[model samples]
Target: MEQKFKRNIGWLQGSAMTIGAVLGSGVLVLPSLAANMAGPVSLISWGLMGVLTIPLVIVLAKLSTLYPSAGGIAAYARQAFGERAGRITGCLFLGTVPFGAPICALIGAYYLGHFFLLDAGGVTIIALGMLIIAVLANYRGIRFSGNVQALVVIGIAAALLASIIAAWPMVRKESFYPFAPNGWVPVGTVMTVLFWAFVGWEMICHLAEEFEHAKRDIKRSLCISLVVVNLLYLGLAYVTIGTGVYLEQENLTSLTGLLESGWGRLAGSIVALLGVAACYATIHTYMAGFSRLVYSEARAGNFPKWFGRLHVTYGTPYRVLIVLGPFSMMVLLTGLLLQLDMSILIQFPGSIFIALYIIAMAAGIKLLPPKSISYYCAWLACIVCIIIYLFSGWIGVYPPLLAGASWLFSRQRIRVKNGAISG
Candidate 1:
């Protein structure tokens, strides 16, 4: 018999897990990105994004109650539509994980090195070191690593809340004077950038197989998680705008420049450190849940059956961990070596991910038989997403569409046997 992962993570651990993954470097750099893209109206767009995401969260949570499994969105999609549709959802969901994990790792490393005032390539080396440790810990299994995750979540949240509050007095009210200075084009562009800030909320339900009493807890956890996250997000946005409007109406570039101006040469370094920590936490959690999903896929025969194999002592997928670690390191090096702007590189992928999510949620709600009419709210969610995507512009929207399309094509190969889609 195949060994079962102990269903040990509960509501609190589960919530921490999800929030930790989503809340990462997003909070740190958002102020800068919002400044660059939306001016002040990104707040409005944010509210829209929050409202739209709620329904999909509800659907995922509801599914957790009825069909709690590691396949997550994949399983939800399968049940609602059919085997091929479900497989498409699964492939899309899993495809992004490997790509994202490594990049996030390298990004966090860049920050780590910066915090220590390290020289060129210092960030890359530190990031790789941290990532290796993280990979080893994850391969050791959740039971051993749960406490560390909990601490990272708590520490990161506390620091962010404190930073936002601490920066409150710096607001200049007039900063938002020329809201949308570049006009609607940038606002839409930033909306796509901000979408990355909100991407990982569904990871909890995807890891549902590990939860205890998943039905009741999943609902409680998602609600609590989103509320906390939203508040933090809004608080940061307010600080950025209010502070900017106070500091003579400059755009994000100037505003960020101002963040360090009062302090001189060492200016903004503190915030920079915070940004790196946030990235580390976010990247760490994303990889953990992502690896779990991959391991689960292997078990279900959706991946190379070999991927399902586990380490003898830790009961983790040692091979997958080994493969993914170096991949993220490579991306990190490419980004830093090229001196790519963080905002441009990171924002585009986020926009693409959001587009993919809109489809996944649509597939889940439409394909599944509705338990209630309110469940139809998912279509509203999709409409909201489309608006955000359009506002974000064609550049931001097309990549994820192509990615999800690729995943859809991969499903065509799965053999249909006895009314079941078999990989």
Candidate 2:
């Protein structure tokens, strides 16, 4: 008998759910950051990121088309190379969970704090609690998780569209006159941050095992999600930045600020409520994906069986969720106790994931067979990614080096002859 995995996910369910996972509070915040760095001309950075991101997305699409296994990039790399390479990919993949998931929880909590007047410690406590609830919801079953994701994602997209529509007429034409006030450095920095925004395309590939029709649906879902994400991002930028709202107010850190300038206090608060809901949805999305990563690692023997086993009735990795909840709670408490901004602490870990993404794009492309278009696009993608990587300000991520060293020390080293990591 063939071993079946999570089988309820269809194209609509998968695409909408995947988009929910990818889009986050970044949408609420990144526009101002981009505009601040490059003025209205920062829209150019959107084009640049789309250029870089599309090729990588294509490579991932090709890989998922070829191999729709739950292992995701780790499975693809392992088939091309060997166990050693696979382990490295898996480790790097797992590493992002620690930072990314907790960051989402803390960020969502912060926004909720804006309304409740929660202190930093109180917000952290609430964030940790939210993380736990999100994880538990997943542990209940994939059906509940998928349904909840679909609802929240639909709400998120609708809320974002409503915000843009409400604010469109208020755009100041003169605000866009002095574009590029800063320079390209901030352009690169903001792009680096936005890089995280386009990240979850490959994550859906990991659910290749879960989707009912893995091969065709996986590729379709990924491409569809990519197009949808790009469209939303571009639309929001025009509504918020093209109108000169960013220039006048100089803040995109919250929908509250954007809405107030574009609309009135009543409308801004309404949008903020939507933003908070979107953030919570994002928080759950983070836990769902990160829990799966834990399940992936545990099955690989890198972690204990406790992490691998699913809940008997729900068929979800309950243990992994349990463990992750407390750890993220600690992150919340520590962030509160030390009075640290979640973004500051998150930047380091987030950079490492971005590095993994660049490497995944490069490696994914390099591993393809000749006579295929993806092979050529992969190398081109790699070169572009390397350029982005240099400008990405992630040279000292610390984790990749330590990770690379650990891989080198434990077994055979990947000989980087002529700048390629190979055996």
Candidate 3:
């Protein structure tokens, strides 16, 4: 008999995993980046995205309750549309993991490098090590990784709180006068960048089947995580602008400077360590979700059947996790060698995620009962994703390109199957 995934996630662990997946290295840098772009008025962009995230989260949470599967949004696409749509959804989401994971790792490593004053090479080495650690944690099984993630979520929350409290006294009334210095246009522009931070709610949908009470716990966890994540984001954005840190230094090290300004130099080091924890937590959850996705796709015959195997002892997708380690190493090394711009790196995968959301929300519209709250929310979410993708610029071409690739891949697999049957 084939081993099945264990139901090891409870409401609290589910909430932590959800939080860890959404609130990552982006929190450490994005507030400051947005501030740099649109000045203090960037807070409007943050608030707008926070509001938009509501229906997106609700639609996804509802979908999880309705069709709890390891295939996640892809499964929903298959159920609502057909096999071709499922393959495209799966491929698009899988594309995000490879690029998104390394970006998170490097951003965390940038925080550490800022603390230790390390060069690019040292930072690349640290990023690689973080990926390996995240992979190993997932290799152990969901129970083990989920527990580690819960603890890391606590640390991440504490770090954000500390940074906000320490920087509260630094707020200047003068900072509010020239809020929209770059005009209101950049507020919308920065939303394109902020989209990356909000793309993670779907990650939890992929693991909904693992929850002890899929319907009850998934709903509870989604509510809990959304509250926690939005509060942290708003507080951090307020401080990043109020303290005028964006004007001083606007990069991954921006959070470090905010802490050092009020708490002391030691606080900078502490935030750096916790930043690494946050990044690992994000990577760890994605690794779990993506590996299961691959496993599910394989079982459906969209991939090589060998990837469908689970670990005999842990009942985890050990084969997929094994492949992730080397794949992550190669991507990180290539990025470092090429000296790629961070903006390009972030925007590419970020656009792919926007594309994935558009399709998933469309799936929700087709599957959910018409005129229900979830169905309405799905419509709103679909419109929101379309708006975001419009802002994706030229990088938006990736989704169409990826869709084409998935079609060709499915066709070739069908041809091979027919040939073997004839033989």
Candidate 4:
């Protein structure tokens, strides 16, 4: 008997999951990195991305209402275009899991190292452990995972609020001088980095089938998460600039310094724990989303069938989750051995996501009613995606490479089918 996903997610759970996915490690690190690149004017990138997020989420949410499936953006692509396009989009999205998920886990590990004064190797070990824990959480199924996500989201919100409030009085006006020290070009450049924070909106469409009332709840969740996420982003960016925490600590641990300066060592310790939880929540949501996408693609005969199986008892995509565990460990280990910078890991996926969004929004234009409000929104989103992709610099080369890989896979699949038929 084949198992199907359970409709255990409501609007609140959907919101929590969406929030967790979008508000991940980027919040902890990107502000400082952005400040480093563009000075205080980096806030412009944050503001621009926040405004752009509105239309992107709307196009995705509207699509989910119309075609909810585990395949997410790929499903929309399949419906709007053809199977080859769909498969390519799915593979492109899968690309993020390999490096992006582990980068998120490493953020938590960095915070843990900061809080405990651990060495680089210890941080690597903690990162690997965080990936394992995330896989375990998803193995329990979405009902259990959704409940856990809600609590994690609340804690993340509270921690961000507390940090911002405590740091408000310490904000020095002098920090705003020479705002565009690197010129406005870097402000646009930083948006490429900040794109990682906004990457998760498309993730929820993968879980659309699991929502109890996907059409209604999807919109509701988007509305709630958008406001909540943008506010936290802007507030945190303000304090990071005002307190000049970016100038004080390494970008990875800037949040710790921000919290310590505002509250104290105790608050920093508490935030470290919360940062770990926030990163776990991110890993948890992406784990769930990526596994489901693999199952969908495999079920559609785009990959090996071995990945298509769901856990009979839990109704979850257990096989894919199991495979993800090992792959993530390998990425973490390789990152440690090579001493890779987190920004490099982050920029790779940020570029890939912009490419993915461009396709997703194009799918919207094709599938949605012509000139409808959502259709216009899709156009707006697609345009912004293109602009961001241009800002991705050399990283922009990745999308064409992924497209080539997808074409090769499709050709091989066709050859196999023809051979089997002749045999």
Candidate 5:
């Protein structure tokens, strides 16, 4: 018998999950990266990206209400375009978690090293330790993890809000001069990069079926999460650039530097701890979503049945969580061993997510009834996704290549099965 998930999540948990997932290490690092890429004009990029996400959010919210499932985006793709498209969507999603989890974990770990004066070895150990903790939290089930996420999101929001308030008084109007020093072209470039910050909302979709009132609560959560995320992102961007700390320091350390400049070392340390909590929230949500995705695929006969098994006592996908934990650690360890920059790993998943967003938006258009509000929103969202993909440069190419390979393998398997049946 196939096991099922309990709908124990309410609007509060759903919103917290969305906010926690969306408010990851990006808040700590992206402002400086955006400033560097497009100068203070990246502020415009931040606003633009946030506005563009509205259509996508509306479309996803509508889809969730209509077809709520643990598979989330993959299920929508499957319904619109058949099994192959759905499997590809699921594969791409599952592919991202191993890389995304470590990338987020390392961000938290890196900042912790700065706070504690830890060496690379210490940081690597901390990263692995954090991954294990996240896996354990998730293995207990969504109800447990969801409660943790609510508190985590509150801490992160408070930290970011405090930093913004402290920095606001120090803002210089002079920093606005020469806003587009790199020209308007880089705004588009930075928009693609900043798109990483907007990715968590889609991730929350995977848990739609777990909502107490999927139709009402999912849409309500989406709206609230988006508003909260955009306010924090814009506030952080303004403070990072307006205070001019980002202009003076390395991108990775700029957020810490900004907080320290205003509120001293203690403030920086507190923010770093909050950053670690934020990263864990993201990893926890991703693990939960990815396990369900794997379970969804397995239930559909796309993956090995072992992955579909749930723990009898905990009622969680323990097998998938157990497998994912070590796999994520391996990625983190390999990166540490190779001395690879975290940015490379981060960009790989960001690109794949862009591709997934495109697929989801198209699926929304096809699956929803035509001439409706959602239909138009899907069209606009699809266009926005394409524009971002075009600006994503070489970073955008890898996902399609991966999806094509997956498609080919899925097709070959289908042919073999047909041949066996015919024989």
Candidate 6:
């Protein structure tokens, strides 16, 4: 018999995991990227994206409360749209792992390189090492990952707080002068990019079944995490922009540059290490969530039965981890070897995530009672998702293509199986 996951998580751990996942590479890099696109006005984009996510979060929270499942968003899709939609949602969410996890690892690797003065070869080696550690930590079980995530979130929060304090004195009012030099149009463009930072909230839904009190605790955790994440993100953007570091050099390690400008190299190095910790937290949570998604699909017969197997003692989805870890590493290696722009890798997953969000919100509208607050929120969220998708440009095209392809392939497989059974 397959062992079941233990519901060992409480509100604190759940909130920590959500916040940790949200605070990852985005906080470390997106502000600089957004600034390069929109100047100080990008700070408004940060705040705007944060506010826009509230409706989406509310809808997801309601869905999780009503129908908690290991499959999370995929389960919601199944309830609302039946088996095919569910399978496609599962595939899209799972597809994110190949591109998304490597992006997180690369973010950490870039920072590690800055901190250690390592070359490309050294960064690749360190990134691969971090990926291994994340895989092992997740294989141990959710409880173990939850604990590590709690500590990591604390470290990241503290580091950001320190960076804010250190940079407080250097903040100048003049930084706001040429704020919209690129005008409001770029703000919309940058909002699409900043939306990447807000993707983690929905990922936490996959762990809803693992929470001790899924109904009350998941809601509380997401609410608390939302507040914390918004404050930290806005604060980080304020300091990064005020210090004018992003304007000077729009590199991946711009947060470190911001800190170094205010304090020195030592402070910059400490923050870089914290960025590495943030990456681990995000990767750990995503691995845990993605593995459960695979386990849920397997159990539903969407994937091979082997993927549903659990570790006898740990109750973790060991098979999924075994398969996914190496696959992600291969993708990471390909990106590194080919010297692909990290932005392409990052933006690719963001598109899929937005598509997933649209589906989840649509599911909420279908599942929840009509005219209820949850239903209304779902409607608003769907609109916001559509707007973001439009702003996402050509990158947005990939998710629909991926989904259509998966749907067609799945339908063909079903036809073949049905024919075999009839014969």
- Per-residue lDDT over 324-400 for candidate 2, one digit per residue giving the tens place of the 0 to 100 score: 77777676666667777666666665656556666666667667887577777777777765665665455455657
Candidate 4 lDDT for residue 33 = 90
lDDT of each: 0.66, 0.69, 0.87, 0.88, 0.86, 0.86
What lDDT score is found at residue 355 in candidate 2? 62
Name model 4 segments beyond 4 Å from true: 172-186, 338-342
User: Which of 4 and 6 is ahead in lDDT?
Assistant: 4
Local accuracy of candidate 3 as per-residue lDDT tens digits, 1-423: 655788988988888889999988788889999999998898999999999899989999999999998899899999999998898788887678888788889988988897799999999999999899888888888888888889999988988898899999998989876979989999889988898787678888878868889999998988999899989999999988898888787576788789888777687788789788888888888888999899988888787788999888777888998888889888888988898886587777778878888888999999999999989999998998898789778888988898899889888988998999999
As a TM-score, model 1 comes out at 0.82
**If scored against the real structure, what TM-score would every candidate get?**
0.82, 0.88, 0.95, 0.93, 0.95, 0.95
Write one digit per residue (lDDT tens) for candidate 4, span 1-423.
Answer: 665788888988889999998888778888899999899999999999999889899899999999989999999999989998998988897678877888888888877788789999898888898898889889988988888889999999998999899889989999999888888998778887788788788888999889998889999999999999999999999999999999989987788788887677686687678778888888888888999999999988887899988888788999998989999889888888888898677777777878888999999999999989999999999998898788778878987898898889888988998999999
* Candidate 5 lowest-lDDT run of ten: 262-271
Q: Rank the candidates by lDDT, best first.
A: 4, 3, 5, 6, 2, 1
Candidate 5, 1-423: lDDT as tens digits: 668777888888889888888888888889998998888899999999999989999999999889887788899999999989999988888668889899888888877887889999898888888899889988887888888888888888988898899889989999978989989999888887888788877877888868888889999999999999999999999988899988788876787778886788677687679778888888878888888888888888888888988788777889999899999999998988898988776888888888888899999999988999989999999998888788777877789888888899899999999999999
Which portions of model 5 show Cα errors greater than 4 Å?
Answer: none
RMSD of each: 4.3, 5.0, 1.7, 2.1, 1.7, 1.8
Top-lDDT candidate index: 4
Model 4: what TM-score?
A: 0.93
Query: Which is superior by lDDT, 1 or 3?
Result: 3
TM-score of 6: 0.95
lDDT score, candidate 2, position 21: 72
Model 6 stretches astray by more than 4 angstroms = 1-3, 251-253
